[model samples]
Structures are given as C-alpha cells and as structure tokens.
Target: MNHLEYVTCGTCSRLITIDVDAAGIIRNLSFLGGCSGNLKGICALAIGKPATEIKNTLKGITCGSKDTSCPDQLATALEQMGY
Candidate 1:
C-alpha cells in the first residue's frame, strides 16, 4: 500500500490524499479545503471501490465556472498514481 498526496488546481480544495491497495482498490480518501459535506460523501462512496472506476466516473467533471472540480481533481490524482 502507498499513500499519495495530490495538490489540486482550480478548485476550492487545496489537496487530496489517497490510499490504494494492491488490487487497485481505494482504501481511503480525503480532501482538504473543499465542500465539507460533499467531500465526506465522496470519501464514503470512494472507499473500497476500484480506482479505475472512480477515475472514469469523475475525470471530466467541471465546477460551474472553473475548469475542474474537486471530483475531477481526485480523478487526476488517481491517474497520476497509474490507476
């Protein structure tokens, strides 16, 4: 297992930290400086799911006027980890 810390751009969140197991399944997830309730919900749904799934589900998402959202940044983090 390895823990990854990804600095985000263009979102309210400043950082995202993730953990994935050998099978590429998400073991833990957290976001810093974003929507509290929404990030909590994301963490709840993401834990134990395949990283690939989450990456695909969130990759292209955009937030209102910005080019990327918290979810999209999470996807970027997963991709950087080679999901």
Candidate 2:
C-alpha cells in the first residue's frame, strides 16, 4: 500500500490529514487541529471511500468564496494517481 500525506487549507474549518493507498484508495484519515464535528464529518466521508471517489466529490470545491484551496489540491493529487 502506498501513502500520500496531505494538508487541507482554506475555509476548511480545520486541518485534515489524508492517507491514500497504492490503488488510489483511502486507507485512513485523521482530522487534526480542528473542530470536532467538521473533522468527524470529513473522517466519516473519507474512511472506506476510494481516492478517486473522494477526489471527484471534492474537486473544484472552493473554500468559502475562494476559487481554490487545499482540498482542491488534494483532488489534483489523487487525479495524478491516474486511478
């Protein structure tokens, strides 16, 4: 299994740590240094979900009114995996 470490930025409400495996799949996720509810939401969404699926859901998502953010970057990273 491969692992990709990422940090979520912008109006993310909190910082997120994402771990993706070799098959472009999410192996585990942890929301660090952030709100409990928000982190729980993210963690719940990410766990057991495919990397591609997660990327697709978060792709092009802007933080607050911003056009780009770390979540978008995370999507890009997943896309780069070619899954």
Candidate 3:
C-alpha cells in the first residue's frame, strides 16, 4: 500500500491525498479547497477503483479557461505516485 500527498497546480484544489492498495487500487481519496460537491463526487468515483483507470479518465480535463482542472491535477498526482 502507498500513501501520498500532492500539492495541486492550476486548479481550485490546493492539495490532494490518496491511498492506494498493493494492487494499485485507490482505497481512499480527498481534496482540499475545491468544489465540495464535485470533489465529493470525484472521491466517490475514485474509491476502490484502479488508480490507472482514474488517471486515464481524468487526465487533460480542463476547467473554464484553465489548462487544468481538479480532475486533471488528481490524475497527475496518481501518476506521480506511480499508479
């Protein structure tokens, strides 16, 4: 299992913390300083899912005119954590 914290860039969320199991499954996920409901939805969708799957699904997503969204940053975090 692995526990990692990532500071976000180009998103409303300031930070993201994730827990991954030995099998590369996301056991828990949380974000700080982002959209409450949206991040909650992201958490619900991410828990118990494969980190690679989530990373693939969320990568390159953008918000408004920004180049990166919270989801995109989360994907970056997952990748940095060796998902």
State the TM-score for model 2.
0.65
lDDT per residue for candidate 2 within 4-58, as digits (tens), equals: 5555556454444566776666877765564567557766877788887888888
* Per-residue accuracy of model 1 over 1-83 as CA lDDT, tens digit each: 96899999999999999999999999999999989999999999999999999999999999998989999999999999999
Q: Which stretches of candidate 3 lie over 4 Å from their true place?
A: none
How far in Å is the alpha carbon of 59 misplaced in model 2? 0.5
Indicate the residue-level lDDT of 17 in model 3. Answer: 93
Residue-level lDDT for 9 in candidate 2? 57
Question: How many clashing residue pairs, candidate 1?
Answer: 0
Model 3 has a clash total of 0
RMSD of each: 0.6, 3.0, 0.5
Query: Residue-wise lDDT of candidate 3 within 1-83, one digit each (tens)?
Result: 79998999988899999999999999989999999999999999999999999999999999999999999999999999987
lDDT of each: 0.96, 0.66, 0.95
